[model samples]
Target: MSEETVRSAKGRMGSFSFEGESAEGLLRIGEVTKSTGLTARTLRYWEEIGLISPIDHIENRERRYSGKVLERIDVIRRLQEVLGLSLAEVKAVLEQEDRLLEVVSRYRKDLDSGTRLVMLTEAKRANDEIVKRLDDRLSEIGRFRMERVERGQRIDSAIEQILREAND
Candidate 1:
């Protein structure tokens, strides 16, 4: 893809030209699905659930996603599949992360030590919540793994018994 910087009305560097199209690193639905291994219906459902959104392209009315949205999609996928978090849990974690970002931004702006302390405390609270959820999921996975291992051992013992009987 060709790269060209385009500035927004606010004089901020926003979009890049991809294939002669001046969109904000915007990609078509098909391209996103192909790259992310997600279906179009899944993307739509995510959008409906306030998880992710497509940019408004009034020209063709087609759904386009920016590069940042693509990264967010990856994050959502990892939270769900890797961390074994439900969609609701993922949403909660995402919201907490956003809150943490807000707190950090405010902390940067305010020079007062007391106010900074409050912001840091809030950030810690949000981080703790996220860590707690992850810990819970990890515990569940551990239990599941132990159960499977025990079952495998029992199966192996039964097979050994059957072999011994056949030899006798």
Candidate 2:
């Protein structure tokens, strides 16, 4: 059986089917770009780069995003705007985050308990990697912010001294 067929047997066939929301609430690329504040070209490029899964395409070749996947997009946006991570870093972080879902969906209780244990262990490892990456990124951001603050203060002090000298 094909991967899609096997996934369908497990009740989902795609990456975005969380809490049953992917079955409905789909948005076209236009709507997604508008709502996510991303350009259409950027979205397409991200998909092309494997940074994001390409959103669904219909018979006419227009693409629609799974609304459930909007949450994932938010994470991408935050990583882009806030953390300033490179595309490669963002992809690595996202892959780790998405790994648990992919692993857990493979579980079948009817199979040996050992299989379930393996899946659970894999999930934990993925979660740990995600957490570690996030923590490191946060610390890096903190240092960046402090450097910016120091620069601003220096600029302000220099301007204030010029004004004081001019008044005297």
Candidate 3:
């Protein structure tokens, strides 16, 4: 059986359904680019850097992606443009989120308290890591704003001093 077939089998087992997306249901690379308003090269580059992966259409060797992948692309855009994260930082955040999702999935099935506690702890750690990265970025922005404000004040003071000297 193909990987897609195996993924479909797993999907029926209640796992995340990323792998089993049918070709007919999948969007071609051009369609994805049009839907997301991203260029083809950008999508390919993101895939190259491990930020995103489009499913391969085995017959024609074309790239395809699911709706969930489109949602993930939106998240990636927000992380980069809104959160001011570098690609590396965005990747880190995505990894932590993926880990948290896995932990949540396993926690739902495992009835043992000890195992649940461990999973909970891991989830917390992943959440904290994401928070830390955001906090660090925010702090950097705050410092930059302060520096710009201070420079503007200094420039204003110099201009005022020059006016006084000229008037005297």
Candidate 4:
């Protein structure tokens, strides 16, 4: 198998780890930037904005990030790209990340135990039902409008014929 496939399999098996990849339980700023696919300047800017902070500093005085920082980066990316949250909103959410992760973890545990149904499935069903209803309503409205237009045309024809007879 390819190296990437082998790594994926190892990761799935929980044997592969990202620990110590960083500098002394903290990743170097460059490593974080590379791992996250974000630019170094962006990471620094985020730090300046108080959106993310490094966990430690090395002897060389370089910033280092912890595992939590990696998680935060992922959250930031998701909030911006998937949820369409603005930078300010993403920052606000990051402030509440711990609580959100706790809640999500509880729900995930419940789902794994089959105790709580996945809300996503229910939401999709409800959305499909609403779309079907809207389509039906639109079709009904179109048919009603067409009937009214036809009736008005018939009335106009009758009025024209009546006027013609009166004149004759």
Q: Which has the better lDDT: candidate 2, or candidate 3?
A: 3
Candidate ordering by TM-score (highest first): 3, 1, 2, 4
Could you tell me the C-alpha RMSD of candidate 2 in Å?
8.6
Q: How would the candidate models be sorted by lDDT, starting from the highest?
A: 3, 1, 2, 4
Q: Model 4: C-alpha RMSD to truth?
A: 13.4
TM-score of 4: 0.44
C-alpha lDDT score of every prediction, in listed order: 0.79, 0.74, 0.81, 0.64
Please tell me which model should have the higher TM-score, number 1 or number 3.
Answer: 3
* TM-score (all chains, Cα) for each model: 0.77, 0.66, 0.82, 0.44
Q: Can you write out model 1's per-residue Cα lDDT over 5-122, one digit (the tens) per residue?
A: 1122113324544445457557777667876789999988898887887775455566767666778898899998898888898899888988998999999999999999999999
In lDDT terms, how accurate is model 4? Answer: 0.64
lDDT of 2 by residue, 1-168 (tens): 234333442353334543344534556576667667789999889888887664556567667566545677888888878788888888998888778878877875337788888898999999999888879999988998999999999999999999999999
Best candidate, TM-score: 3
Name the regions of candidate 3 deviating beyond 4 angstroms.
1-18, 22-25, 57-60
TM-score (C-alpha, index-matched) for candidate 2: 0.66
- The residue pairs that clash in candidate 4, if any, are none
- lDDT winner between 2 and 4, please give it: 2
Q: Candidate 2's C-alpha lDDT?
A: 0.74
